[model samples]
Target chain A: MAARHTRNIVDRPIWKSKGEASTVSFSAFAFLFSELIQYSQTKVKSTAELENRLEVAGGEIGRRLLELLTYREKAPKRKTRLLDLLKFVHTTVWPYMFGKTADSLEQANAADDEYMISDVNLALTKYISVPRDMGSFNPGALAAGIVKGILDAAGFPARVSTHYVDVPGLSKPQTTILMKFEPSVMQREARLEPRAT
Target chain B: MALIYSLYIINKSGGLIFHKDFAPISRVDLNDSLRLASIWHSLNAISVQLSPVPSCTGIELLEAETFNLHSFQSVTGTKFVLVVDPRASSVPAFLQRVYQLYTDYVLKNPFYEVEMPIRCELFDAHIEAAVQKYPMMS
Candidate 1:
């Protein structure tokens, strides 16, 4: 029986043979991201189109991340409360996947239905240098799109935008990824509001 | 706690692309960063000069405090320096992940500078996460 258990070079990962998979490599991701950028570039003739395409791409990522984060585990108690969820996204969920908490979380000005979480940098776009021929490409923006997409797909209904916010004295410039919630979100939160202590 | 000293990435041409101080190292002097970078730059050049072309030390690592400071050089001439805690197991894993992030977010981002210290938000965030997981790090 032991002799019959030969490891195939292609599927040598013991865990996977037992029906488990492994993590993806960055090289693979680079090719994928590069292709994604190329695909996004092909759809648009203007800067706005490119930006929108990047956002849509990010949104797709957000959608996947949301599902992966929420349902990937079996918790004794499910996440409840708007603040709880926001915190989860800001610190727990974001860091788990992307590697850090957002730089800031702010309430939208003159808007009761909106809130913003700003990330000084988004990693997925780290290596990419938008060529002069290409409109300025920002991966953080795409990441914001991803977040928004995930939140929206989860019925949270929010908009995310990644912007390059200049900071004084840094080797690499900083990025600000802003997430804005929709008005309906506020109303829904109000209805689901927990009782005051 | 064992603190990470700093990180540096040098090209095969002796160009210093990136250098970062992960933890504090006093008495090393403020300009020590640039100086050390320069020195390391020369050392790397000399290392390559001494070795046969294309046969030079590729991905060389140096350890300090056993699990603390380490330097890694890739064949592509990208070097990663780590000043990590003493008990962080799996140095290979740590470096591999760092390199992965470098290749993904840093290298992929159009705006990122090669051989220069990384200032990408994603890289910082990811490193923060990794450090947070280090038991010795707060």
Candidate 2:
């Protein structure tokens, strides 16, 4: 049976494939993404629908990337704390996806479960142009979904929103992603901290 | 000996995202290339349906008198099609290398907008060198 299986190729799991960090052409990616947006435009009824489609597509990629990155790191244990997971995403995951580290991470003082990750030039939307009429349309919606997907996989259910912020000296607009964890996640964190101490 | 002539990548939605000519062939008009891409996409789907086996993968190769067409589809339905001299035997290997380049340079590039016309210089340079190095093309 082993011989028979070995005789046939192309039957391995995706994770079993190599995990080396590599880079591809920017124009190729731009072309492919342009098609994704155009395709979504045709299938959806409204701008919200298009953004949702892009989000869904991004979430799918994020779910797989979460697994791929974790496996690549070969860390002895998985991250559990909310802060640790967020840090991992900001430092490690962001660079892996965008070729650079995120600009900043901030904890919102007003809310217990609120956090923010900012990128001076969000990679996904670097070259995207939104029509003036579609004021709410932001390509970063896909990035937001990716963040939500990663957080959800880490057991911290969260909602993520993207906003643009212009810094005085920067050529490109900065992007901030606001992440709000569900109440249960905060409650779980509160419950878990006592036991370790 | 086999020589590569051109390559085209069609997205799942029947859109042409990448098109490159390795050796100079007659230039295809932009609109015609789009039409050809959609036709290939439809034919790929139709070929799968016509397969006797339900598990049959779509068309992999088409041979003609002077040239041959080789194709590979990613899990996400992005199709890579290559036109090469009919004698080519390493088409799969070439396709895999191009796919690797796509994942590395194109997918990983921060400035890349998915599904748009590919304009990455590195990808072009790498593929150009690869094509030129082929036994016949060189």
Candidate 3:
């Protein structure tokens, strides 16, 4: 039998539009985010506290975006494994942000619960250079927070942190986001593990 | 393709970061655009993000003789910059489309950082087509 040919299905519109592309100044978003960080910095005292706030901020984004995108993929919701979900975030989500997906992903040869998603070029530090004065406060780290927020909200509880790894020419240090799953996540994995073996 | 008159992305501290033009257009001073972007980065950053909500800053739009510049400020404060043909009638829509991409792709991508320059090729492709419809200057 042939597939259904409903106009609604055939003409389903994507997020794309026919209008001309919009434009803005890079400087516009930079200083604004800088202040957001600065103001958010005031809400906390400890480094962890500030970082936590940033993560919370990203969490809000994660939730809203998750709902929005998931709604688009509502029908024929494909069943996803833990790993598959991770890939979805990488291929689908990452590109939405940087106009590309993560550079690569790796499994820890030594650790079972460890997975690595590395993007040689994380967009945050691409243009705005983080000054040295802000000791231990990595602007790229917030990107990490954004990642974690999405993962957590997506029910893939993992510890994701952004690191400024060395890249040859791309001054914006390539960020290798290390995602470590907690014991509970592993336990859930074990329970959810289909007994294929 | 001819020079599309790409826009420049400068970090808050001022640096040449990302550049791309959606349409083929006039000559562009890469160095000058980058310099200006960096210099203005500080001011634009402060102003744009505090819009209807406090987290929507970033390159809003760049419109002029050749191409338009637009930016999307992510929740975590990453920026996505786009350069489009100035003559494109859908420039505003293109920016919105990029924002949609940002929300759907970038914001959702566990790997993407907030308020950072956009590096997602998918978003770029969309930008390319959105602005690609512009007529080339003779």
Candidate 4:
């Protein structure tokens, strides 16, 4: 048995080559997420607390996913600039997890440190119907957590929150993830801008 | 036509988490169902010990003069037991669909605690719909 096991390992390595795109079924994720929200509901008294719990859970996934995805890239390069990092999350991370790129990435006009990532219809919220009593509860908090986790891990510590904005023509409200970078992070980005150019 | 008399879900620790009778008139009382669950749990364990094979799962199927008992044990050690008429077909398939419903409704429900009795309205509704798909003996 031991000899055969050794022979098998030599012939076929366990790990798959890069860019294979490991994926889980949407229904499977939906089921697991539903359970997560339900379990979180039992522990929190307020919707804010529930969102915080979900964000924390999502943060863990984001941190790990960042590491895994970078390793999977053909040319793995650590994102150092703020724009590069945000674009990575927008183009790479969102599609990797949700099967589609985020709808838009926009800089907040009022503040240099603030930015927004919006989705017309968030995949996570597609099946979730927030209870009436839990007014304005957003499961998108998990996605915000993911963004925060990725940014923090990538050395761009920021505050991220999920919001629902009503669009005039759309039946469903769009989800916008707002991010506010720390003062220190903005200072670092300013210093690196000359070299980045 | 298949006659599925009842369905029961037993948790890993051998406690009855859910039970439903589909016959026109209920045959087993709550107490009787509880007793039967524990009895089956013990019997399953005993069968495993008695088996000469290394990894014998307790009882998969048991045929009697009147009814047939079909059991499917998931990887988590939870057992889904179905009691139906002797001529029942595709018992395993029916149980598989029932297990999927358990995961979706009972497990996914936020208010539900693991190993506790299932009382989810959505679960009950879906189970009824799934059972209806199978033509009854009538």
Point to the candidate with the largest TM-score.
4
lDDT of 4 by residue, B1-138 (tens): 448889999988889999988876558888889999999988999999999988999899999998999999988889999999998899999999999988876766555678888877668778888888887776
By TM-score, is 2 or 4 better? 4
List candidate 1 segments past 4 Å from native. Answer: A1-23, A74-80, A131-137, A169-171, A194-197, B1-138
Best by DockQ: 1
Enumerate the candidates' DockQ scores in order: 0.22, 0.03, 0.03, 0.15
Best by lDDT, which number? Answer: 4
DockQ of 1: 0.22
> CA RMSD for every model?
10.8, 12.3, 14.3, 8.5
Candidate 1 lDDT over residue span A137-167, tens digit each = 5655666777677677767777666666667
Instruction: Specify the CAPRI tier of model 4.
Output: incorrect
Candidate ranking under lDDT, highest first, comes to 4, 2, 1, 3
**Residue-level lDDT tens digits of model 3 in A1-197:** 12323435447454433332224454555555666667876777866676677767777777666655555553625424677767766876676566677889888788888887787656655434343444455556666777677778777788876666777876445667778888877787889888996
A188 Cα displacement, candidate 2 (Å): 0.7
| Off by more than 4 A, model 4 | A1-19, A195-197, B1-138
CA lDDT of every candidate? 0.64, 0.80, 0.60, 0.86
| lDDT at A127, model 3 | 39
Model 4 preserves the real interface contacts to a fraction of: 0.25
Docking class of 1: incorrect
